[model samples]
Target: MEAVALHISNGVLNGPVSAIYGVIALVALAYCVSRGRRDLDDRLAPMAGLVAAFIFAVQMLNFPVLPGVSGHLLGGAMAALLVGPWVGALCVSVVLIVQALVFADGGVTALGANVANMALLGTAVAYLLIALLLRVLPRTPTGLGITAFVSSVFAVLAASQGFVLQYALGGTTDLEHYSLGAIAGLMAGTHLLIGIGEGLIAAVTVVTVARTRPDLVYALRGLKRPQPATAQGVAA
Candidate 1:
């Protein structure tokens, strides 16, 4: 069986660290449920469902980056861009929970760490990055696409850093075999390539949705209306 390094394995994190992450993840999930309830109206139901399903499927297909390392779509950033941040976090959390419980894709005990890194950090960072980018960039489809691409990379990179932090604290993995610096370096570096793939996929998806169903794109919702045509142009 090929070993995967991204998801923290069971017993890799000590009880204290795991408990801490569990508490944090639970708090975030509660908040997400509260927020998602309001956001998941009939209008958003189909889009949200589709986005969650797509993310789940994409995450299953991992691309190899190195000898033992592989990376998959985190999907938090893309979900946030499509839905709102809170609901986006919730969407990814659902996938992580199901993957952990049903598929045993991630460590059962490490569910909290996985959710915290992939769902909370990814969605929150992506939301902040998008907001910051939108202030400077024009509010057009092209501009939104650029924002999605950049945010996706940054969000996944941020999540990768979160993993490094977890590994630094009470991690039972090859920490004794390898230095913290080495672990951080490898995690961040590989995720950089993963982020590139994430950015491209997110950008293309956002552009396609903007072109086809602009109304469903939450990121582009508040764009300013174009100026009205002058009387001469209207007459002509």
Candidate 2:
């Protein structure tokens, strides 16, 4: 996903587009931390924090997806699937900040757009789509497997749409000249395939946690049990 480039490849601050999202991410992070959920079990906090850190490190891994386009797992869906949406978004925003401030991975000013595209939109959309798909899916392992498989692209592209909009707004390029539809479609489409990896990781992670660390499932709230079928779909 092009959004992955924001974190993996350098030059986040070199451009204005990235800097905006980076800033937005920081602001949103502060808000989430201040108003974040208090019901988060103590045991899960450390896991979630470590998970966020892992996602940050993963972003550093620049995998060449195409000739010029490189990508990395945003991990928003993973975080969301592990925890809840707001919490997951918070996790991603924190990682983005750490990347920009400590590792110099993303741009400082562009944090806003990055937050919008990668953390907020990506996590929220993925969580929603996964939940929806799960609700309608056969409720069998095969169905859940397929749900997990396709869930990534929804969030990936939703986040990509955030990028397309950001690019259109202050992209410093002619929207028409760039062929927004073709690019967005292609980017989202490619990410659809790439997201399969993310989907598998999410599905397996959920299943593993459900089996081993059911207690660690941050999304399990009030239920006292995290139905192995629904690991973390805002179940809280």
Candidate 3:
């Protein structure tokens, strides 16, 4: 049996559903581009390029999941944490577009669904979780690392479900042996392991950057640790 990449292939979804997702993706990315304009400045602009490139490179290396299914780094959480959410979406979208067009990794017709899932849904979910985690967790390198790990895991799971939802809506595959529930369960279970691997990579990467230059970490920017009481204040 040939290996199946996690990316949705052509003919998996009907034309109407695919077209609907394509429109949604275009509109969402247009919004991102509008917002990303403000987010991309001197520092972030360069970082965005690097983030996109890194994601593109890493996604090429696939790991075995089930018998014939393979998975790779989604890079949604990493991009959103490293850059802001808007630019992060763009980064992931660019990667997916390139992969589809150049490498034919994913189906060209399914590009919209791919972008919507990995770029928009994955990035949004991860960033929201990171924001929530940072509010309670210590705003240190260790804390950010933990946040990255947790968020990445959930992000991958969420992205996997996005596909399930799409499949439910307009799946062309025959379901003689498998039901929708079975498909969802399998996707969730396989993606759980993929999520763990992605989480570790995301954690280490975030922690390293946060330690060296926390300013560049978009997730760390708003987090402000309370200053410790000084010796002079204590003496007084």
Better of 1 and 3 by lDDT: 3
The residue pairs in collision within model 1 are none
lDDT of 2 by residue, 21-46 (tens): 56666677776666556645676588
Better of 1 and 2 by lDDT: 1
Per-model TM values vs. the true structure = 0.89, 0.75, 0.91
Best by lDDT: 3
Comparing 2 and 3 by lDDT, which wins? 3
Q: Cα deviation in Å at residue 108, candidate 3?
A: 1.4
Model 3 lDDT tens row, 1-236? 65545588999999999999999999999999999998899999999999999998888778776786677889999998899889999999999998898777789899999999999999999999988998887777777788899999999999999999999999997799999999999989999988888898889988888777777888766445554454122112
lDDT of each: 0.83, 0.66, 0.87
Which 10 consecutive positions of candidate 1 have the poorest summed lDDT?
227-236
Clashes of 2: 19
